[model samples]
Target: MTTDSLILPIALPLLGALLATALPRIAPLLGVLTAALTAMSGLWLTGLVWVSGDLSIVLGGWGLPLGIGLSADGLSAALLAMSSLVGLGISVYALGYFSGSERGLHFWPLWLLLWTALNGVFLAADLFNLYVMLELLGLSAAALGALTGSRDAVSANLRYLLVGLLGSITYLLGVALIYTAYGTLDIGLLSERVEPSALVSTSLVLMTAGLALKAALFPLHFWLPPAHANAPAPVSAALSALVVKAAFYLILRLWTDLFATITDAGAAFILGALGAGAILWGSWRALRAERLKLLAAYSTVAQIGYLFLFFPLLQALPPGPARDDLFAACVLMAVTHGFAKAGFFLAAGLVQKKAGHDRIDELGGAAQSMPATTFSIALAGSALIGLPPSGSFIAKWVLMQSALETGQWWWLIVIALGTLLAAAYIFRVLSRAFGQEPTPQCFITDARAEIPALLLALASVALLGLAAGPIWSLLGFEGVQI
Candidate 1:
């Protein structure tokens, strides 16, 4: 039942993409239907995992060496659930968003394809298939980023495309090396067979670098801000909230599973150092950003740094309840940021549309006009700032606790500084909401668009944080360790 449920999330979106391209006029209806069905299927799979634990299936009944396999563990199920809910919200928002534009027709097909890719990445059990999913995801994302057709959007996304190609090539080379070494690409098989060698180490480096580029880690993130900022709001939301997470998921999977025996303190610390750089650099840039979307884009860089900061601490501890708690915390942070960032981008889009610009200073009046949008920003900003009761707050607390417990006190300093920087930039935007402007006739403008943004924002702080205990149980952990 769980394996059957997994196929629907991937298949429904592919069908929607074809239907949307063939029937552009009714694309919005098709998109909503796709989102509803896909989201339901994802939820069903998550429930099955909760009840039955990990599930795997090999396509065509050709088990092992010749078959494509799909698997859903607690981690995959959690991400799938986050993507489905957020995807559904974005689809509804897009319905009101693209109503009168030619780009609207282009959006549904490309977006659904992107959705298909996200699902594929989460459920794929083979390394080579993950590479295929990454390629499709990259192509669709680059195309979507260019939907605005502005000079900046086109040029930025072209660079994004080139970078994505380089990443894919590097990742594919690593996959080839792995297959040549072990004669198979199954992740579970690799975990049992992998042994430390120069070739294996080099392949690990190649795969990590490729995924880092895709995930926009630190120095490799040059293409992110421009591409994310210039895209349509829904596109921006999807890119930051869903697409990058897929790449990072692979990196985490490889490190924890296939390369676990080979991981060392030096390598983990190096990764954490890069994360520190991203935190300081990305936050400083976001503080100085003049435009709202660009600020949000830079914040994504900083938020990703927080995710990576979990690595060194994870490596420092032995496998136990403490380590498991940190692992679950990192996933919770990623999921929380998914919902928060999506809401932020959607609200930013509305602000840009109404005010005709997203300049932070000029947005004072625009921010104050729509109560719902402002409220959405406030909720999301709370999460971004790691304020109490937000999932990030809980995640960061666990992360810092681990850092301290492991005697790696330096990371705590990094977290503190990053938290301060996050607070500064988040409050910078929120402050504008108090500026004088004519009162809005209602808390919302188009309920279709604003409500989705509001609901997602609310979930980030409320549903994910206060109720996140189940994340451990869903991930198959013994109990809430923290």
Candidate 2:
């Protein structure tokens, strides 16, 4: 299929979101079906690219230096696949997940809008276009974040909104810088044109800082934990799994296309330093959190740190060596983390719903009764903790080797320590839920609620040790070092 062929994947949800405003009664069914179709289409698109090389679709008839465009290489497609599947999972989870809420009328529309923004963010090709999509994504996410209407939810959403705007403004300034310097905003065009001038350096800083803030990278992540924990379960899963990733994807895209040309020693150290800080700070907070949702939310801050740490990993290229394997590791980590974190949030949400509170001390032996959900949490936790044979384990292995190869061994230490932190927080929750305290469930979230989290968890586990050929092949991009 042509790249344009999958345009419907982006269009369908937006259409549904619009339709939902008028037909809230049918919004749940429509949203669920649209998500399923989008995921299926994404799978089909990925298979198409894998067998037939990559695809790009220019908006209208415009080419790269002129009008906006959309492109899909293996990396973009892989993330698209993640969004597709995760979106469907969130949608289904939303169905039952919303039943408990008295606000389904508002939930369905915002939820569908979020799906649209996610797909749009993944598909965007031009720098300016990405800004627009990210802005749309930001507004919808903030609106969705505030939907729960609790004091915490409102407070968190307000913080999230302000922080998101700050990031957006910074990113836009960077976009303007790029346009002024090279007169091109298309990534492919910028790739061919960018040079190591003051303008390029400033733009890189603005863009990276903006994306880091949006992705909740450490030091700039103050808004993430409360924002995520205060939202409804499905919403939290979507925010943690997909929304934070939008900014990370932007950073990855910018790195590959523009900054790759200016790759040098100082920038590498600075990015790596931030990544190290995020790993330590987020993990420390997660360890101290007394509640499950808060713990998972903080863990997201830490996991996001792992994504930025890839900056150092890719930088480890021996001046002129292949960065393909390293870049692949970064993509795999982000994708794997997407599934693992989503599953973790969904499972946490389940625990909170059933227990009526997410406090760790009160969650006594509920896991035995909710065996399947508990098991899902454990399996997902395995991936998060980077246990052997999980996707995250392979990501860590690749990262460790890359760090060792380049002699930047401090990041390796961070990975090892962060993994242990991941394990500690996960174990804290699981161990408490092991025996039979027989707390009567304050509420029972349905099995439909359970399946999305479980599928995403299974996906996280299955990602580990995935046949190398598929992922390796997906790393293909034209005329790039990695």
Candidate 3:
């Protein structure tokens, strides 16, 4: 009893992964085809979710407790589509990205596997199943991150893998607690059964800590910069854009439904405070970083900080127009940032390739030389800075309004300051790129490399001025005014 709707997006790549593995040499070509098919199906399935409320598939003809299941609500499908789009872009960019290597063959399979895990986790309505997928994702990502063959890459990935294991174990501990307390791991049923108890509260705290670290929340974000900064470009893009986000999406679901009415207000505030700190600290590092990739990595640290800031706001609002506005705003922030940040990272990859290094101060006169790539980076940076006509702008506006509605003026202040800091760091790079160098490097052309970067960047910017009607619709929340 597979929901034909849910089956295609998840199943196809899985089968493709097997095929690509069997062929070995067709890894690159097959990876692209697989990701492209997944993206298209992701888009189509999202449409099905919108037209119908939610789509679900039960495995092996057993229902509920005895069987596994996948479900797509508005939120799940939107993320699926985003993952597909970003995954496809990563695949295309990787064609020029990994090029020729004994290592490249291994990269394609692991990457597609990562994408499958991401989409699976989002659609998973089963708890233990999600845990299994999480483990798969962590292992694949760590393997991919270590692919560069550089000592630093291996070292950073080792640390990353260690941190990731701790987080997963913590999350698993929470699941064990829930199963012990409630006797079921089905999310929908658990939502109905979840109740406040000493065990429930303890489990909540444990899960929160684990997911926070995985999401690279401040104080626990120590592993992110090193891993991301040291990883290769395509891997870094996937890690930053999609991998870190998987955990955050889990946190959102936990807080929104499972924690229903049992919100630990004090804990929510603590996360918010740390999120703000991450914004400041990460932005400061980005402003100071001598290397392009490190700058982008730190920017991810800052951007992800913004993602967690919504937890407190969602907890504070009453579930009505106020809460819905907060939800929409947060969703907008996540999707918008996903695209923009990925674009920024990909564009940075091209810049590093052309300049032979990514030192900001040394990048004088790049604007005249690599206008397509540079402009795309600058445009993607605009979304990160919350400029108007961008989805981030609209999202931030709604978030600010939510703050005002709740009299959370301090939250308002923090948002404003974060915007200014983001602008400062983003402009630092742009300004350095445009500086008048006595001798601009006559860089060789690689349209194959630059085109994908520009297309992704343009998509990020287009998200601002244009409507997200299709994307939002696919998520089943179109015209979903609160």
Q: Evaluate all candidate structures by whole-model CA lDDT and list the values in order.
A: 0.91, 0.82, 0.84
Q: Which residues of candidate 2, in runs, are more than 4 Å off? A: 62-66, 100-102, 318-322, 437-482
Clashes of 2: 2
373, model 1: CA deviation in Å?
Answer: 0.3
Return whichever of 1 and 2 wins on TM-score. 1
Q: How much does candidate 3 score in TM-score?
A: 0.89
**Ten-residue stretch with the least lDDT total in model 1:** 434-443
Candidate with the greatest TM-score versus the true structure: 1
* TM-score of each model, in listed order: 0.90, 0.88, 0.89
lDDT of 3 at 312: 80
Candidate whose lDDT is highest: 1
- Writing each residue's lDDT as its tens digit, candidate 3 over 1-482 gives 22666877778788778887898898999989998899998988888888877888787779788898888998887788789888888999998887787677988888888888888889888878888888888988999899887999999999899998999999999999989998899888888888789998888889889888888999899888889877778888899989988998898888897777577778888888898899888888887788878888888888888877787888888789888878978888888888888898899889888889888878888898899988988999999999999999999888877776777768776777678778878887888788876333333368889888877876785553344666777778756343
lDDT of 2 by residue, 245-273 (tens): 99988888887666788866788678778
Clashes of each: 0, 2, 2
Ranking by lDDT: 1, 3, 2
lDDT winner, 1 or 3: 1
Summarize candidate 1's per-residue lDDT along 189-302 as a digit string, tens digits.
999999998888889989999999999999999999999999999999999999999988998898888899887889888889988989989999999998999999999999
